[model samples]
Target: MASREFLKILSSARLGDVSAQQKLADAYLTGAYKTPIQPANALIWLEKSYFSITNQALEGASSGSTQISELIAQTANIPLAETFGSPAFGFGWNSFWGLAQSSIESDSRSAAQWQLVNLLINPINQDIQKQLSEWIKKNATSLEKVSDLDLGALQKLAKQFLNELSESNSSFATNAKELLIKLQPKNEALSSLWKVWQEDQNEEALTQAAELGLTAAKLILGLRLAQLDGNTETKSNASLKKAAYWLELAAKDGDRDAWYALGEIYRRPQFSGYNAAESDRCFDRAADLGHAQAQLRKGASLWRKREKTEEKIRGLQASYWVWQAHQQGIAEAKELLNKILDSCPDPKKNDWYELAQFAEQALNHHAEHKLDEDWLLLSHRIIIANQFNFSKAELLLCEVGQLQHEHCVAVDIRWELPKILPRLIQIESIQQRRALLAAGKVFAAADLEIEGNLRQRRYRFDQVTSWLVTTFFKDQTESAIN
Candidate 1:
């Protein structure tokens, strides 16, 4: 019969049925349950039943089998496939005893067997070493067998068990460390594991390990202590000093994160009085160590400092660093780069085009860091530069103050004020008049008559004469002097 039917036998055994319990144990040991059934799970279930049977036998009561099915299932760790039908049931009392013999070693076997069982079952128990020592003394033969089993798997199992125990019991961690040291004397893994245990926020573990020169433990313990001394007004300097000591050691060990933390400390207004120069150096060092976020921060510091400097080259240098950071994919670096490039002038037309193309490629490459504001401003500049009247007006405004209304004629107003003025005047089509006004040359009476007609509301004959005397008088005076 398949082993599943053995569950029923186990149930019957639990009700003080000795025959059923023996039959179930026989089914598991002889592989009569099914083909390809695992012996490990079979042994576990049989062993539990054997213990119950032994307990009953000792008590002189009906050896009712213990319902250890739940414990068996919990330890199985693997899945079982369904059996199609029950196999032929063979009745044999001798077969049950033989199956039981293979799994349950005699008290005479070897010491290794006892140690193996103890290690597997009670690996995390606090008294494991003592219990193992006792088992070795009582069952030397069992221990011999245990030494023959796989050592690697046993060590892994022990570590796993100890890890679980360490979660709730600090003493277990100490014991586990001792065992690991005995097993792998020169290995660093044990030390590293202990370090993790110490850093765990458990107060007991942290204090104990921090005293043992565990750097990470020391750092975390210091931070926790600082947090407890909350009233910074009373203990501010002391707290910073403590934090700084651990942080300096960690930073000296090439911990880039430690450098960044130190930078934050020095940069804090309350702690370091905002020492920008010192903070910048720290951030720069961290950035050099391939700290991506630190690169961004360093670039920002330079950009801010550049804003307060009078040197134009300083502004460009700031933009250079920001671009360097942007190349490293910092989002804020692109914003800073845009602001710098917006106000800076290009020395050549080709350079200006290249700058525009660079902005376009930046938008293409890093869509998240697109220089939208700078692009829009440059685009507007290009559009205004293309218009003749607006360009002339801009140049003229740079040279002269705001144009007076009456000085519209004879003043050589090369300044194209069309962009500044409302659309009421159409200066684009009057190319000749615009040229004449720009050259500081007087136009013929007929041309003036046309202008008077075109802008009659603002330029009447009397007003036109007054504009000539006031606005063009400078030119007249210059001509007389020449």
Candidate 2:
């Protein structure tokens, strides 16, 4: 059973309320809201909340302006109050809660960016301070946005909070080891690390960056280390070990490129972590996440000589993934999908396939002649299939849904429905026959009105009905043949 409160908050979160999302994450984290504590579910909510808040902050940065008067004037046409309270704009709660247009001034909204920033800085739930600190500790990519804070005081405060919440692998601790680095990135390693690496082509700067859990630096360092070849066994062994360590850190964070790198690395039997099983697993993970080339490789991996049953199953799986990659515009995937589909058994034996063939033929004939007898065949077949309890007959009807309204009630009554209604009345149930006859009479009246012949045909309903019965159903076998 699920908690109603948790379900309610989850709905609000899904509706894109940033605060609701954070609260749901908190609920999953603490388990105090009668929801079970699940770290994976909590991380999902936390990710949603963080991205929502960050996007809102970026929007604020782009849209906020110092010219507050123009922004306010843009909304002057709106009659609604800024806030709602009793005796609006009066003393007590109303004084602070509600304000009319005349009460507002440009000076009051001068620091719009600061106001948006303050929302994240001091959220409704104060516990987010600790939650955010721990979150950034693990997902270090968030450092880019945090580092974008322009105010020196806010930057200093953020560093202080992260520093207090730091752990052994913490990015804050690594960057804060020196005051200059924490305050300014370029000068933070001005003297030795950056100069040693940039000017000298040494790997020291990369090592420093990787240690701070920066994903790009880790990838570069891993690649460089993987390329190392030493004259002695001691250094050669050390190089691969360092490469594996750095790459593994990035891969664990669900970096697709890092996982692909590991797959390439393990494909070489000489590498430290080289294992056929691990290499295949890495490729499978990347492919499952929509990597185009990885999808090709994953499909190819399963496409091999095997037992017939096993091969058939793997072939279907490979075709599915390859088809998805093709839809994503991977040319290689498209070529592979065509080959796989061609090699598979024919699909025309499916029951729906037969129905579709009939539909296609009927549609082509109808396309050539607006009110073809073939349209009668198409409609009767669908109506007959539905009577026989064909599960997909309704779906096929929907596929040709446009034809239903293509003819006006006038056309449906005269040359159209009269050609088929006799057989329908004979085969359909009593209730359905009555409904069809009643609808047919109404349509005949409408058809006469549409042709400006209503007064001429007003008393001809019984004559038309009697004619249909005598002409079509007068001979049962003739009606069936038509």
Candidate 3:
């Protein structure tokens, strides 16, 4: 059931309040803004809200818990967390219940089972876990849903939970390994070899399998050799040489994972002669071949190497690979992309930089020509200017207006309260209320002086406002369309 507080926020958000919309989006993302975990809704609000601070550098770090701290740091001009309330607090639910319910309704037993296992690792009460254990026994026979949870978080949680069980002497300990294999399955033959090798503490079967051309098996064996070689590179160690031989064989057989593994081996100078160039090539090959992890590695690698050379678009190139990985549903990639995009400038989109500058000026209450109902009809000019062609700015602006006020929203009929009034009157604090209104003014204060037919330079009003609206979608006339 939705909480009363969530309901109130939603009501305000529906009425077109900018702060409400942003808060609502934040809530969905982190439950911090005092909202439940509903990423779909969060994305909607994020796409809809136009921020006064659009600089990527201004975004709070992706750490869910530190959002408030980060927000406080970003808005230093305002006495925050005090007379003016900081964004409402709470970490919304990012739990197993949603997936568990989906598992119950779906038909994919594999997926359901995975969800149940994931749920098992959450910080649930022991009683709940016992009940869940029974529930899994009931539903384990069948699975029918594949959750869209962030892969990185899921993997981390899985590893942590499984590691606990592996180290414990509890009743759950016996089946922990089985559960991991079930939660994230691999090639059947390779898995079987690993199962015995890991469980029995015997490597004979796994080694045989690697020799028999099982690529996954070979990768595992190579990893074992690398671990055994420890911090010293032994050119004479037959084990290390043998590991390399098998890794090369796997790579030759078109195993992308193998190439990445080889890169990892070469990356560690502690082991032996770590050739940075060779390691880079191996990683690059793996990235080109579409290994998502490898793509992230290369992205970070290139960015780190930027200081010593005049590398053109080093960050951009890195971001492109990271973005590709993010699209493939890698959560770590999303986190990295967020940081990269926030700080990296888009040379192709200088307009974005201009917009950020305008946002900064507006927030400082320094923007000019922000009022409406003018003779020049600046709002209309912004739409017709075509200077921001296909910039996708309009959609965001429309959302910004609605976000400021629950009512009086739209491109033509925006809730244009005075430079002193908030879009949402529900704001109670005088300073807080004023802060909201001021932010709105900042958004409306876009007056771009561009070269014109009548004059060398002309002020374009509502450039920021119209930019809040984006027509990136087909056949629609609402801010929500884009």
Tell me the spans in candidate 3 whose CA falls farther than 4 Å from its real position: 1-201, 228-238, 270-273, 290-293, 307-314, 324-339, 343-482
Best by TM-score: 2
Every candidate's lDDT: 0.42, 0.45, 0.47
Q: Write the per-residue lDDT of candidate 1 for residues 1-482, one digit (tens) a residue.
A: 43444466768966756456545544554444342454344444445555665676678765243333232322222111111011210111112212212354332111222222234444354354444344434444433213323445554554554444333333233334334333333236437556557466355665555455455555555554444324354443346556656666655544555566667667666664457677767787677655777877766767678658775234444554565677778887767666654321222332234333333333334345443442322322222222222332332222211211221211123333433422111122233233323222222212322332223413332342343345445654787999
Best model number under lDDT: 3
Better of 1 and 3 by TM-score: 3
Relative to the true structure, candidate 3 reaches a TM of 0.33
Q: How many pairs of residues collide in each model?
A: 20, 0, 31
TM-score of each: 0.28, 0.34, 0.33
lDDT tens readout by residue for model 2, 1-482? 77555688999999888667766866765563467765445555555654565576677744333222332332222211211121221121111112121234332222222222222243332454344344434445423323333334443553444343222243223222222222334445544565566577666676886676666567667766776323243344346667777877866644556667677777777776678888888888677655677877877666553234453123555656666667678888756665555321232433444444344333335444353332333333333333323233232222121112110111112232234221101122432232233333333434222222333232332333343345334454475789
Pick by TM-score: 2 or 3, better one = 2
Q: Model 2, residue 21: displacement in angstroms?
A: 26
Residue pairs with backbone atoms closer than 3 Å in model 2 (clashes) = none
Per-candidate RMSD, Å: 33.8, 22.0, 18.8
Instruction: Give Cα distance to truth, residue 163, candidate 1, Å.
Output: 36
Arrange candidates, best TM-score first.
2, 3, 1
- Candidate 3 residue-wise lDDT, 377-461, digit = tens: 3333332112222133332223332332221112221232223221111222333333334334434654423223222212233
Candidate 2's displacement at residue 475, Å, is 28
